[model samples]
Target: MMNNGADLEQCKRLIETSLGWGDAATWTNEDFDTLSDRIFEKTSVRLSISTLKRIWGKVRYDSSPTTATLNALARYAGFEGWRDFMATTQPPAKPSPAHEAPPAPQKSPTRRFITPLIIITITFAVLISFISARIIHPPAANLPLRFDHRATSDELPNSVVFDYDATPMHPKTVMIQQAWDPKRREKVDPYGKQHTSIYYYPGYFRSKLIVDGELKMQSDVFIPTKGWKAIIIGDPLPIYLSAAETTLDSGRLSINAATLQAKTGSPVFNSKWTGFFDVHQFAGISGDHFLLRTTVRNTSTVEQCLCRNVSITVMGKLSAIIFPLTDRGCISDIGLYTGFTGVSGKDHDLSAFGCDFSQWQQIVCAQKDQTLDMWLNGRLIYTKPGNRSIGDIVGIRIGFEGTGEIKEATLQGGGVPQDLLKQP
Candidate 1:
């Protein structure tokens, strides 16, 4: 759970990244509605539109979000939970005093004399009160809090049960957090012995039991994947596309535009392409040692627009590599989270991909022992060392903001590099 003002600010940034919005002020009511739908689609948890607006500062609310809300948002952003996101991701650097302007020039003579005299009088009064308080009472002991949790089954959609003990010296509130999302939270009897919750998705989840506003007990829960699944984030509702629906095109797996329109009854712009590769199909091997190569291009010939934006995600058990390609100057709008580095958004320069996107572009991203390296058109584009562990290779997803085509794509596990870009 977040413990300070800085934590709240960081949480807001995490939410913005997850929703693909660069800033809080940029979020609209429609955006919040879409977020509400997306969260339910991905996590099976419902965060009300009003609550989301309040959390994102879109609406005036007197109170901050509950711990449950934070956990849910964190999980949506590819963290074990909110606590994991905060503990692992580094917050933005604070502005240094050296970089700030110096204090204003000294005040006039009469103002200066009066300010010093007032300061001296306050200091004398504070000193006298401090000595009197010390003589009257002694220092107090720290508050005591205890919590422990367990799951009914170490599987997907498992139920987690918690047991906790907290000593409240004063009148304080007590609640249990199932995940970082507020909807997953509930107020429990302060003296109660246990509480339970159900988790629908597979990932590393950090659970917390809170007393008052502070987190008292915490633990992690891991749910393994069963197999590969395809999801189409379409308008009106999301459809679960099946492997049987995909066609093999010159050694690549893709869904045709006519098939997409037939299935969704909508245009390609209303659809979001997402596919997950089950570990079981690849000999059930899971780890950070994996490589993904895919070629994509916009095939839409609509007279109104020629450029189509695309993004590919290498989904690991605990993290993901988001590679976004679009017309020059549009990459900054993409949100990517690497387990090692913190979340990257509009503030980060992603101009490496700002170029013509109509033609097929080859992208290769590899991860060996948590160190991720990427190449575009056989040219090394970026590399970064990871600070955290890459839990497992859950799958990968290819998507287009409007409409696009996939030429070829493959996932390799613990294998020698291949000349993927060789002409077909």
Candidate 2:
């Protein structure tokens, strides 16, 4: 990916510029795809995702860029940035000692010894005082408190604007907040459904939701005398069919198939369809796994009738900490091959394939009264607990496993209405 030194510099600059806009942790492979392709299209050398990561590493360490790298970097930015960066980062080389006249150097051994002794005595006195202090005044009942404040890369003044990407998991709307500046805010999918915040701290960056005066999702900081921490309240629960309001902070909602997105008051995140996955019925640890059923109304001019059962692939994750995110395909880019799928081994291999994450998540589809379990090929794999919890889900998908489709469809969930599932 690093060809000419200049090309490398240009790529690095572009990446830094882009990272300046959003959360670096939330970066997607698609972003790299776009950046690399654009660089190649404009210039000749190409950069890969791995290459981009390496450049970021350099920036983290305050390293200098070579001449060739700088020139290429200049291509991606305004003249001012590239020019200023080059001038500021590069330093003038020092002349070799050999090129200058040699000077006679002498030092007094007695003076050196006296100075060293004086400094050593002072250091010893300070150490003695510290030890005495410790002995006389021990720590309180609780240990001394320490707080880890991570810094984020968000700029000084925060900004917000419309997101016009046709992608699936991005915010239809946005909420920009900066500690220093007045929020530069705008709403795009005021009708589409959610907002996102790229929160910048001094050390780490978090792309989360800001309290829309409307969604009032707020949390309290319960820092004790021992330590300090703030719980995130303006946050949605983990992605579950049972996602409910932790409190009355209006913005809490599942970012799945059933909820209507009011962009103006959209929470913090939404589905950015990077690709698709199957959601179906199956048997499980909880019981009849997921109830897979959907009623497809003829929205198209022709007869809108599906024929096969929707295939649901469940990936296993130990922790759902990074469970729901904007970067969808980053976790399973290649083959999704674990957990449970389709049906197990009764009549047919009703089974589809599955993938697993370090975190845990259950994918199910069902209604209030009815239940649906997993079937791979035709074999029953798992049956889930409860009913179809996917909020107001109307449309179910099946293309995640190569080229699959939901054949039979019916919407009978006790959640929200079925018609709300259409793409806005």
Best by lDDT: 1
Point to the candidate with the largest TM-score.
1
lDDT tens digits, residue span 1-424, model 1: 5445577677667667655777668765656766885566445578888798887667788776787787777776767677788778866677798798678997999998999999999999999999986666433245455677777885444777777666433326677766545455678877676777666554455566666554556665555555544455644345665667654545445555666667666664433454433332244434467777888875544432334566787656555567777667556665555553433446677777654665678888777765677777877666766534455665566776545567777787752256733524
**Across residues 172-191, which tens digit of lDDT does each residue of candidate 2 receive?**
44332222122323343423
In model 1, how large is the Cα lDDT of residue 244? 73
TM-score of each: 0.49, 0.24
How many collisions per candidate? 10, 93
Report how far off residue 5 is in candidate 2 (Å). Answer: 8.6
Model 2, residue 318: C-alpha shift (Å): 4.3
Worst 10 residues of 2 by lDDT: 318-327
